[model samples]
Target: MFRVQKLLVFEFEAIYEPVLVEGPVVLVDAQGNGLRQYHMALTSRNVVFSCDNLFKNSTRRGPSDEPSWEGRGQDPEIECLELVSLVPLECLRFNFYRRGDRCLMMLSAHQAHQHLNVKEPMIFEFGGHNFKHHFWYTWRERVASIRVVQPRYSEITGSSPFSSSDVQLEEELTVQVQVHPRPIRSSSGIFVRCYSSSGEGY
Candidate 1:
């Protein structure tokens, strides 16, 4: 059975202009042999931001193997991350703000998922501001347990004017879940709701 107990939140400000950013976001537990694999599904709101300008990249290091590249400047392992087939969100929005003549963009109602081989540590990076606000279950019958590490937030300077000073927030509670591996389940739904300290849900 898979049970959820902890939830992690990572919030940070974008300081650089939109560029190709890539890295791992989650780490998968590799059984014993010291081998690891990672997977990620990415989606974004259809705002003016250029999707082409955004890129996802990954690098894996094993005990004996040199670091391998997943995308760009490549060694070829077909680095393209697979996108899962599912119902798209009904609506999407991008919130924008200005501070001292600089434009800041925030993704609203944005969600994504990553699947990794359960035999390796998972690490990832993103090109833009990635806000995690929900979790979508695809293979509900195959998962036996689920745990989320509370995400931490930090701002990258020279990207935007938004700072940690612009907002006040609290540490999010972690979520852990236990579930049955089989029973023919479809569509297990979970969403993250974020609110400001002032009681405003964003």
Candidate 2:
């Protein structure tokens, strides 16, 4: 008879990367589709949306040291960080919702602020169900610090300043927005490493 030795099982829970929670959160549409592989950062001061392939494979620097959007020949592996949109903290609204099995955080323009370029609310999905409370609380604290209003759906459909008719007028009055791609050396905020058995994380 062979004696069996004791087996030690170490268990752990799944969690999101510290970067995903803190600095760059993947942006998704209303239906949960990724928005051109873009990411957004919501800090206490302002909101910044950027498009990059930092999580992808290539790394080639474009001319002028910034990522070039001028051609597709650019290295796909190059982590090109392109500025998509930037909105001030005071010019936004925040809302949270639980749908099906997912939690969503919505960012929209503040009713009183009309100069923003966001024609619609930007939605970000929280994939960490287990960490939803932590996630919500973290964001709530940041958002609550500012006097932000919850967006109203009716305002989108009703007579609002962002109405279709006003879009042209708004665009005509505002300066043309330009997108520039730059190398993102490091995202803002502290980053802590999270371990996963599968070598992957949200």
Q: Model 2 — which ten-residue stretch has the worst lDDT?
A: 1-10
> Residue 120 of candidate 2: its Cα lDDT?
72
**TM-score to native of every candidate shown:** 0.20, 0.44
Best by TM-score: 2
Task: Report, for every candidate in turn, its global Cα lDDT versus the true structure.
Answer: 0.22, 0.41
Candidate 2, residues 52-160, lDDT tens digits: the string is 5442333446534533355445433233444454455556566665566565667666677755545677677654446544554455444543333434322322223
Each prediction's RMSD over C-alphas, in Å, is 19.9, 18.9
Residue 67's lDDT in candidate 1 = 50
